[model samples]
Target: MSRYFLIRIGQSLLAIWGIVTIVFVVTRMLGDPAVLLLPLGTPDSQIQELRSSLGLERPMIVQYLDFLRHAAVGDFGLSYQSFRPAMEVVLERMPATAILTASSLALGAVLGAATGFAAALARGRFLEFVVMCLALAGQATPVFWLGILLVLFFAVELGWFPTGGWDGPASLVLPTMALGIFVAANITRLFRSSMIETLSEDYIRTARAKGLMPRTIFMVHAARNALIPVVTMLALLAAELLGGSAVTETVFSWPGVGRLLVQAIDSKDFPVIQAGVFLIATIFVGVNFLVDLLYTLLDPRIRLGR
Candidate 1:
């Protein structure tokens, strides 16, 4: 198990390195940072001076090496737009994004699992069909459009929630619902399929044949086994949430890392952009690594050293 963990850690490090390299290259490719930072009619000489001051005058390889060196020591450089440490800016908004992601994930998991479980038990019934249809529609709806509609109804019409911003708990309801609903739809489908398969297994049949209570047979025997795949889906869902939150955050005008990232991109703030991408990638890699470790705990048959 220790060996397996070490291997996973190594892979995660490699993945982070690749992400860092890609972000660096792509941000540079966007255009000269000096042009973005300076005024519209800035003189070429002034731009060169600005580039020199910012170390953009150096060779691409040299600049990249410097970036990697600073990043290794947790310095992502000063933001071109904010003139503050890039990571500091990212961290300031991290909590809002964390809260949004957590709320959405919890809401989605609960709703999806309950609905899917019900559908599985009521297979071929009207309730099951209704649940399936709702799941399909949820999955088909775009998150941004859903967010807008939610704001329109809940905030604009009913005034039950704030239209945008992360002012308080009430402010979170609409955005979380928009994001959660989409995630829930996907999870419902996954859980339904997994539960259906588990229910058809020989163990489940034996449990039923032994006259186990229906609830006990379904929840204890079937659901527990079916949860492995559900857990896997949850992990993947976390990564997707991180990526998808950019659009959601923008739509809601929530002051999160995702919203900050969008702001950085719009202003061509290379440092902040690089830091944001790097941080998100690191989280994605870390979550997947943790999920890999969880597999062993979930299923003993998944021996690590195999």
Candidate 2:
């Protein structure tokens, strides 16, 4: 077990390195941000001066090395627009993003689990059909468009929820729902499939034949085993959610890293963009590691290679 864990840790570190390299290259290849420092018709000499001042004159490899060095010391350079440290700007907005992500994932888990259980339990019935319909609709809708429509109906027309900004919890309702509903739908479908398989297993059959109640059959014999895949899905969703907030956060004007990312793109703030991607990638890697740890707890057979 120790050997397996150590090998997995090395693999994870390699994965992180690969991701960082890809992100770095992609960000630089997008276009030179030095355009921001140039005037409408600036002389070539002045452009060169500004580029050298910002260190854009260096070879790409040298620039990357400098970035790594400063990043190791927690610098992350400066924002193109405000000139504040990129890390500081991202850190300032981290709370709102964290809140939104957690609430949305929690909302997804509840809706997903309930709907999944209901769909599986009510298979071949009206409840199953309705659940399927909801899942279909959830899969079909684009979250940003849903967010806009929701804001229009609830905030503009009906005066129910606020249109944008994170003034209070009241402001979070519509945006969180918009971001989470689809995730819940996907989770529900995955959960339903896993549950159905688990319910048909030999252990479940034995429990049912022994006259155990439905609750006991599910909870005691099947539910925990069925949940392993769902846990992996939820972890992946959490990772994607961090990166995906760009669309939702922009639509709702939430003060989060997602919104910052959009602003950074507009200003060609490469440092912030790189940092944001790395931050999200780190979260994803961390979640997967935890999920691996959870494997042994969920099933001893997993630890024993059964």
Q: Quick one: best lDDT, which candidate?
A: 1
Per-residue CA lDDT of model 1 for 192-211, tens digit only, reads 99999999999888988999
Local accuracy of candidate 2 as per-residue lDDT tens digits, 1-306: 678778878888777767877877888877777777566888878878877878889999998888777765667788777888887888788888888888899998999999998898988899988998898899899998999999999999999888999778899999889978977998888888888999989888888888999998877667788889999998898887766488999999998888898888877888788777777777789889989889789877787223
Name the lDDT value of residue 286 in candidate 1: 82
Q: Backbone clashes in each candidate structure, one number apiece?
A: 0, 0
lDDT of 1: 0.88
- Supply the global lDDT for candidate 2: 0.84
Give per-residue lDDT, candidate 2, residue 7.
81
